[model samples]
Target: MTRCDVDSVVQLQISVSAKRLLRRADGPLRLKQIQEMVIAKLGRAVDHQQLLDVLQTSAKNGVPRFFVDGDMVGLTQRQRPGPRGCKAAGESCPLQPESFEAVATQAQMAQISKATKKLLCSLGGCMPLDDIQDALRVNGWDWKHEQVLHALQKSAKNGVPRYVLDGDMVRLAEGPSCCRRAQKHAATELAAFLQETEFSSCPWNSALSLSSFRGHGEFLQHVVQDERHSDGRPRFEVRKLHGADWIFATESAKLRQQVFEAIQALDAEVQGRPKKLLDESEDMAEISRLGKLMQDWVSGASWLTCLNHTTLVDEVPGIMTRVHLFDGDGIEVRLHMFMDPTETYIHNHRSNFFSYCLSGRYWHKIWGVPDGEAGLDGGHYFVVNRAKDPSFEHPVGKPGHLSVIAAHTHQERGSYYIKAVTPHTVQPQMDGNVATPVLTIYIKDKAPGPDTLVRVANKQELASLQQQQREQQTQDCRLEGRHRLERLRAMHDLTVLTSHSALRKKPRAGVPCKPSRSSPDIAG
Candidate 1:
């Protein structure tokens, strides 16, 4: 078959597998589980990233009639997904004013006018033009830049309290005082300049001389280096440091894109090369190439995007990751973020992976089980039970001795190389009341493990493992719901604050400012 035909056949197989899996399950299946089933059906593994791409495409096209509920994928009861390109729901749907395409009709213009007023009012009268456009887009109106600016200009020409176009942003004429606007504009411009201008050297660079690092900040005031001799066991240490300028959210997003593209390109190139010709050292060189690409790409992005995408893993609480994977030979790359006050059960994977810390600190423990006895026993049994089956009363065996492969509290951008069979547990290193975010990138070799928790112990452990896992699933759902509500509440509060500010503004001349057409403000 041609490549396109092969892809079509694979797609068909995937669709069939998804249908079969959903039919057998009573509820939505975890994405990890679904991927496992699909892989088994295919008889050949597909990249995790490729699976996500398929799912994302399916979602966009409303194919196979599936819906994503957090990390789970399920067949929606609805015959079709919700209408796309539709504005936010409610009577105040910005689409009420005008259709996305044509010039705003009189009634439509009125609706747009009212919506804009409400938006500005909620924004305390004036906001960036880009922000205004974002609000419109969120409300489902896709107006072009020219269209928005034209409308703003028209409104100014009319006998109303017009919006002032100040550089890239627009502000309500009656909003913040001229002095306040000037101050804000200057600060905004300065911030933009700072963000855009590339620096010659980053303060966080690990290669800086010891004398240069002296008295840089209060945090480094008591800097003490460990003079202890190196042990043979894996000892994590800083491999690289991304300076503050390079660690923003927008910068992270750009880096992720670059890293993803680089991986995809590298995989394609490596696949065509003869396996016999490529030695271990050559493979390492290829990986180093990818790393260098990521470093080069990270120069201009913001750290805020990295934080924004920091998501809690569906199957594991206290563990968060921003993942990007590549096809061919199966490589999964992720930005793993750990939070404090975490209790994580020890588990092992069947892939050699590399981890590099981006920020914060974490307590790392690696355990090595004896060859004959490869599962949890003794005090460690509690950790296993807590992990696999918390409720079941299993006969606890005599405490087994586990060789500690490596254990340490790692801070800074430490690099850790973990073997496939080593079971480890990592938790946030606390500082007083808060647990700072521990950011790291994990590049796992080969396909991911089965959705079922791995245990080499006797069959007794398997008895209620699935049942226990099912019962534990609700926690993930609850967390997802709570996170969504929190974000919604924050947006609502911001809108309310802006609306009240608009209300308080004095009207131009003797005329009272027009009241917003939207419903009463949500309590801040």
Candidate 2:
């Protein structure tokens, strides 16, 4: 044979030997190890570079047989067959390996339970069972899918389960308390930090990394956990402003005002205006159209200019902050920041209005109650005469049991119209890291009369309402001119910061402007 023919025959022999060596080995081998093994199997004097060239060429060409990573070389996944029960070639078998017993030991079960709890806590207390099993396998546990499911089921039957299965979803039963504890712990740490420092509120990350805090992992868990009261109000004072987290003391009024102001400012700049009003007959369509327009509006002249005009900021502690954005010619615009859910009472507005959600989400329930049944059928009803007494000091009449006509989760950028006297209540959802804020535009279609007719499920709730009114009356005196203006100024700052951020994300088409200042300390 010619010299070229001999070279081809030797190359073929080397390729076969390399593949056989790799197939017998358990894992990747170094290039030198592979070369030594290949030469021994061939029982001939083979050039090292020649063997490498053949292997490298095989890996680089179509249908690569082996992969070369630096000096390490191993058979490509496609070249190897997967283990038993694996659906695809070279994929990790989801089923436990043959060496592992079909049933897990007591010690293995304990380990699984512990790992599952840790996973649940890290995953915000809820996840699919399949996902949990996959996570376990990835973490080196070889428990079968059936074994993991069995362990979870057994634990759930105990007096207090680490997790409960809902269909295919596994949820931590103590999720609320877990979050609450985290919140309390975080608040305590933050309060102590603030007391020692001159700052009122500290950036979330900086606080987490403090050497004094030490518990970095624990602090992160505490901060990120979603804390909410049984009533669905946010329990944590963690606020996200200008795209950064800020941990504020529960009583840090000045810092709270700054955060609120930042939100108002950003919202105003991003708020859109409708091109034309849809006839009142198509109220839903009209509201949606207006919402889209508002959401789509690009940053323009600062809405902060409008803040200078007549404005009223009102607050019902633990309930809502109502800011009168505009009021004229039988029309009113208001921005409402909700701190608590309003599901305790069902009521209707005096005027038909359009509401748009800027951030967070809420469940809006529409009720249908027959007339004159106002306080009958075991329901406590009251006439909220806002026109006669805007303070809501006294509820005049009693109303009756109501049925839910419709309900929907109102999400960000969503808008809806509520006709005058249409019974409804807005209950903010508890999925957010902070309280939700709602912006509403009220159009007075009719002259003011009885502002609202509120119905409660029981007398206990009616008593609660009376108690709330008394507390509100006491707090009303505190929301004075200075406080209102401070809120407005904060809102202005928020708008500027938000608008600047939006501009940074997507510069307004061709318009060019210098970047705005980095977010200022809200406490300042």
Candidate 3:
């Protein structure tokens, strides 16, 4: 044979040996390792440069079968004929059999490009090329790694490239920082609108229009669409109302509707009489019914959504999260989550309300003074006029004592009704262990009023209140609207998990396995 024939034979032998070695290996093999193994398998001396040249030539050809990444090498993953003798099986098969040897069509390239961009976005806009290939395979894309790369290259040829390949890492050419910033800005704008409107749904022209969103309408819509596709509950939803688009806070809207229906049913049963007039037995039965309603709502996935959209989340650091669910006419509903065993200062409410415990335990104390007495014997009185003073500065009063008129250990599913101007305080129960989180629902008989009174027993107690206020202000500054919503969702998820696990334990006969409640007179 001539010298050219001998060279051809050596190249074929080296290619087959390399392929065999790679196919047998568990993962990508180093170039040096491939050469050594191939030579060992051949049982003869072989030139390293010749092997490299053969591998490189094969990879550069139109029907490339090998992938060379720096010093590492591997067999390229190609789509094999399915069991049904087609590239895609079942209903996904094309009308005609597709040839594996043919180049990817324009439509195929476009689909690959779109999927690649989505994968990059989900991966924070950068990923190793191998990882991208593996992810594409996992997602059921039949395209080979070479096909994906070619499609990306073709898509970038005419304009600013959307993606860049550096060494083995594939990244978005423009990076993801700008996109994330725009998304956060859009979320902030929407959150601000919802907060300003008191979580009420608004027309598209009012909040989502280009003019209203300052020319970011398209981008905002994209952000909202992406959020909807995510695993977490979406922040805003667009609904058609009277043939026009309206923006609704997703969780708040659903919760408000549920509460409205519940209240309507209750009103029908009361027959125009004040709800407070229900005798003890009737009131207890109503409370139980409402408790069941709450239990059903909280047990579902929508409760997580409610926690996600709550505007008053994390209002008090380490103490409470008060979510305002609904406020209409003379009735308001609020959900409170208490994390610590701290007791609220003795205080009075400006409206009658019912408290239903959703989980955990607390000590409910009612205080009162004799009809002819000026004040309690050992209490420092402070009139809290939040209407006139947003700072919650307390007006001083003479020190006095207060008698504990009624005290009860409020357990899970327990409920209580307190009349307007009734003095009360709630201290979470601590039975020689860490404090359990307490969740409560409050239904008020009137619109929230600004005037209430708090009585502290000593200077230490007063100082603690001042410290709590300072901490709350600091926390409020640090937590943005989007972050607050995320934090609240996480907290709610953890609480639900713990509560569910506790409920799974063996139950005692004749005792209910329901959750706990919150402060009777606490303002939303």
Candidate 4:
């Protein structure tokens, strides 16, 4: 028996050479002739029947040959059957299409049915029942329309992957298999949309420590769960953005310009009033003004008014200008994506941290402890909830390096810190308290030419987007992030997540428990 490898594309029971063939004969021939011819030429005693079985099994048509007076055979595969017409490239191989049923079991079909309904509802409920069934039909699903309807009615309250709510109607959520880039943008847009549009007064809202940037899961979940007000205060469901998760109504691309304009309006009224003068009492009016302006934008009340187009002076200390790195054509490519994420970084003195990576490599870190592993031997990142955050500002103990006040045993309430440069080191610089090592990074700038540390950029536009989500949406995104964080834990490859079994009580440097990833979103 002959085996096929890269050396040749041969079949079993044959030892032939391409050069020996010379296209054998332009016309076709029989197997017996070639076998006999081989015997005659090589003086080898090759069995005719044995040769017939080999040819019949290996060649589709046995082989092609020149007839010697008509009663003969050939050694090529053409001996089996049809024409040797060449198929053009991309012509599908003759393999039959794999049956969908081969992959879809009864349970899978049920799941698809459920997922389909959820997707539809999330889309706005505008799609008729029949339309959904039709969608499945085109895709080769074997579920009945009733199956989909049942799933929708079942998960209407909590929302499944599909059938996300758009007001009263239901529509599809972005499917999981969508393109990665597009899906990410969609999630961001949707999260923003929900943030701008829906201000759910979730009882969880009180628990939500927004000032902390990242905090406990329960509080974050509270912020999301209250988006629609289960008590029936008019629902504002999240809309499907470009990706997997549904965004708040404010996230719509259609209203992006409007939202930015709204932020500008708020910015114009009173963006720069010195942080000192704007304390809670004296700045009460200003805070109200900014909030009101934001409300106007969310409400879509004003277009780009004279004030809307105007840029405000951002004297809100620490809310520095997010300057742009203009290219030759003066196109700004590198600018801070969001100022709010970094707000607590400036405010929290107790947060001992230092991290330095390129601008493209920042990531949000937050998660629970893993089982049976030692935590890192350094200052762990402490969660900061604006609601529960310390009221007074601490004096700068030292330029940027100090180790104190790491006393609180805050669990993994982390936020994203990306490397904006190379050889970055994110070490804690707080005084007192050594429960964990706060992972702060230092950057060495990867952008061209080296003008990185000046921090001269267009200040974060004091503008908010047109929020479209119902109040409940805000609750959804944060909670979802927490849930996703759990899955993300495995990705970090840190097995020493928790150490409950240890009897000797030692100071656990909590840094090891922080959520991280084996690979970052940006490619190396």
Candidate 5:
């Protein structure tokens, strides 16, 4: 047979499920390695397309279609030879390569540039724009000034990870006097200026010395060691003795960041410790970006798209994760998973749910129209969601009441579910020895009043079942408490006697066992 172009059939590992088939081939072959697998199954000179053609065919017929899919290929009982014959057959197999498992190819997994890649798991709202820029520089990466500004703009809380000294490295300060001379000279000159001129004209009546300076506030205090006037006369530069100036700055929410720092400091004080900073090594910009995305996901509202049906309670039997609750109070998305979805009912719009299985090993099913279930028209469904024919505003299922359903349908498990727009009822179950799905009634805008009003003909049996549950619980608690008390007594008895044995046994050291002189005497 003529082979297809070599470029079209890339040399890739066969799918994991396909490799087992190659192993059972009657001819000797290296089935593990891709290159060796093809050569071992066919002659070394066999064209690559020819090998792929066989693989493709097997892939199609594999009962469990692509391992990810539910359809999988299973060898029939007839396909399996006797144990003795199989071992003998293995000796004559052409499979040789051991590393034949298929995986996502490099081309498929190739990542885009770092610039385009979205970051994950980051703190929102940290630091002023300028500080974030410095942090990136420390890591030897240059960030555009505008990009950093944009990051700072997005966060509601602009806070960055604190920088701490490394445990392995010694942290010696830029050691005193780096800018102390500047501070000292500035104070001296200011004092002279005050004496020569009016103290009111001076910014301060009292001068601040280098000794008065603190970190950050002091570090940026003196940018220039010495500043000169136009006449070349040495003019003392009075540093602010505080962090950078924020007056009239263009950094968005600069003041907010400062307030946040103040709050953090106060919190640290209440905790009876200084705030500790971790590695100053984080991309504040990317952290800010992810923070924004998370914020948007939370803050933005979701518009519900209505799918077909009202009062359709579908349950997949046996799936413990069947009770999948989809809840959104317009802020949080809550999904409660159970073995069966039908075991749930909407009581007061309790929750909505939908899901589908991608793998069949865990069998599931959903009972619904199933091709020909007649619709209960004018049933309970919102007019907003399904607008095509618009469901009536009245709630379905006997008009604000509970319903029982037993679902037994479909061959493979059901997953891949979606419930949107309005809250709906769902439960899940697995295949084999199918379990029933229970649904609690949903009473919107009303407190749960009571259970279904239907009276059971066998009241005694119902009471007995309830009594059995309560008894079992009480018995378990009593047994646990009894065992606990036994352990406590055993542990305390030995220690107590040992600690006070002399007190209990001691009566009188020199006196007889008879009465004492001051006490009543006993006659013989």
Candidate 6:
């Protein structure tokens, strides 16, 4: 089925589930209870967050007729069905709400309870009794300390998703699983081992030599076990980022080594044959070959998971995917994926890198301060020393062979080299629901300058850009254009006021931004 069709079905099922759960209830139920009931009745896996999103949407649309309270949900007056909607006098009604005891017998419910316990344990082994009571107390269980403790103890004894600690401190008597101790040991050892031996590369950099680490076997075993017994939720930080086994270290290194060699060979040929002025087509053809090579290298490798810390710089969009394909002694390969309507703030990198667009097209721009001095003052971009007046700086050479325009085309599925000091930004070509994926191979220089790259656009410029986007969106807005326009105006006024306050605090002198010690890095 289509995604929309599936979503519609899920929405209807959720609504039906809510109605059945509240059919005979006299008051509100905790969201947790509602979630448990919904899952039990549907006999399918569903995310609690997903349920919340759908419920919120339903409320906005005036369906399901439920409202949310603090961790609780209640049926609206119109939604509380009468007893006539329940099953016939003797037979049990599937639509009628069941006590937690009735649902607890199910294997799925037991597993969920165990997961909850594990999550609580991860936060801290010990929690207040009140919080534990809320978790263990299912429907029909009186909110008594003794009853909650008894229920948890019974479950723990069954060895079905058992908990080691189930008392006033809401502790885990047992770990998440039988080998949880080993898993924790491996995870800890690997994290420490990585810090010592691995380079501080972003997720978009290559995976360091995991096999070379002392406890490689232990780490691999832990990951394998974690993956095998995973219950959807993450138990540790690494799992939350890339799960347990997104990529095999040995295989990734081997493939990356091959790609690096090929790139080296290409560079040698280009350098040796400089007399044979290469056309744009020839350069692009070479890039296409490299792209094919990368595809072959990643034929069996898993590179879809997020690989790096995304917050490389502030004010960058959080929707992009930066995956490191290969990191070698003097080079690194990365895959960058940008979602629709992306307009990244202007910034520069600290290291030299060559990028090849693997898919889609984008508009790129790069601006550099003349004489390496520039700053913002009174809502305008200026290039000058702190002692002089501000003026605009002209663009230096760009990566691609293109004339000056509003934005350069970071396209052609071909490679182009960008210098370490060059400042640049990219945005979706049409600025709508499109994705741009690029592959970049960074060449680390032995003596690159201190890389202190910072955002060049002042608050005023950013605000104006945002306002333009809002205005463009409003032009196409059908049902909500009026409301959006009002919001846009309010936002613009606020921005203006904020900018004025900021201007008052600005130093009226030299460049708005001063170059600091450059480090080896890239822009967000």
* Candidate number achieving the greatest TM-score relative to the actual structure: 3
- Supply candidate 6's per-residue lDDT for 182: 43
Residues 52-122 of candidate 6 have per-residue lDDT tens digits of 65554464344335544335565543432247454445433332342222223445445544544654544
lDDT of 2 by residue, 286-384 (tens): 444443333222111223322334546787666566776444433455666565755536777666666765445677777775566755566654565
lDDT of 3 by residue, 130-210 (tens): 777788889998876656765765566458766665555666676455557546666666666654553346776666453
Please give the lDDT score for candidate 1.
0.48
Better of 2 and 6 by lDDT: 2
**Candidate 4 lDDT, 295-364, residue by residue in tens:** 2332231111112222221212322222121122111111121222231232221211222111112223
Candidate 1's displacement at residue 429, Å, is 1.8
The estimated TM-scores of all candidates read 0.35, 0.35, 0.42, 0.16, 0.16, 0.29
Ranking by lDDT: 3, 2, 1, 6, 4, 5
Q: lDDT for each of the candidates? A: 0.48, 0.56, 0.62, 0.30, 0.28, 0.45
Instruction: Give stretches of model 6 more than 4 Å off.
Output: 1-257, 263-289, 299-319, 368-406, 431-446, 455-459, 462-524
Better of 3 and 4 by TM-score: 3
Model 4 lDDT, residue 311, Cα: 26
Candidate 6 achieves a global lDDT of: 0.45
Candidate that beats the other on lDDT, 1 or 6, i.e. the better one: 1
Instruction: Rank by TM-score, highest first.
Output: 3, 2, 1, 6, 4, 5
- What lDDT tens digits, residue by residue, belong to model 1 across residues 149-262? 546645643475466554455656553344234334332332343354332122333212223222222112211121111232211122234434221112334455666776
Residue-by-residue lDDT tens digits, candidate 5, 1-524: 23244433332333332455533643223323444555655444444444443333333343422111011122121133346344553333211222212322333222211211111101111123344455555756465443332232222213521121121111112223423454445444543443343211223213322223212232223422344444443333332425532111111122223323433432243234232211112222222232222222211111001111121222222222211112222111111223333333222222222221211222222222222323344222111212221222222232121122222221111222222222223344445566432111110111122322211113343354335434443121211244433322332232233224424756687853321111111221
Cα lDDT of model 4 overall?
A: 0.30
Candidate 2 versus the native: TM-score? 0.35
Select the stronger candidate by lDDT from 5 and 6.
Answer: 6
